[model samples]
Target: MLLLALLEAAGIAKLGASIGAGIAAIGAGLGIGRIGSSAMEAIARQPESTGDIRTNMIIAAGFVEGVALFAVIVCLLCLFL
Candidate 1:
């Protein structure tokens, strides 16, 4: 019985981590995708604005990437803890 309880607890912990990682990816994907598409459109419409558009896009992408990275770290900690 004790072994079964231990196994169940481990399974729950793993499941929670997996879910956290998956949820984090969703926000990252949406944010990056939006920035990419908008940047492309901006460049297409005004080629001269490419430089500015790209700069802003990079900054926004970095922020999104950071959040995703944080989520990944949290997931890792949850699993190991």
Candidate 2:
């Protein structure tokens, strides 16, 4: 009985981890998309500052990706450990 309970708990943990990872990825994608869209609008308004806007957008996207990656790693760790 204890063994069965432990197996069920592990299964639940894996499911939770997968769901968390999916949420993290979706959040990151939305964040990056918004950043890109806003940057494009800003560049359209002032074409001369395109370089600066582009640079900032890339940096923001990188940060978002980094966060997403960390979340995914944590989730995977939960599944394995």
**What are the clash counts of all predictions, listed in order?**
0, 0
- Model 2 Cα displacement at 11 (Å)? 1.5
**Candidate 2's TM-score:** 0.88
Per-residue lDDT, model 2, residue 73, is 100
Candidate 1 ranges beyond 4 A from true positions: 1-10
- Every candidate's lDDT: 0.89, 0.92
Residues 1-81, model 2: lDDT tens digits: 776458657688788889999999999999999999999999999999999999999999999999999999999987787
TM-score of each: 0.79, 0.88
RMSD of each: 4.3, 3.5
lDDT of 1 at 54: 96
Residue 9 in candidate 1, Cα distance off native in Å: 2.0
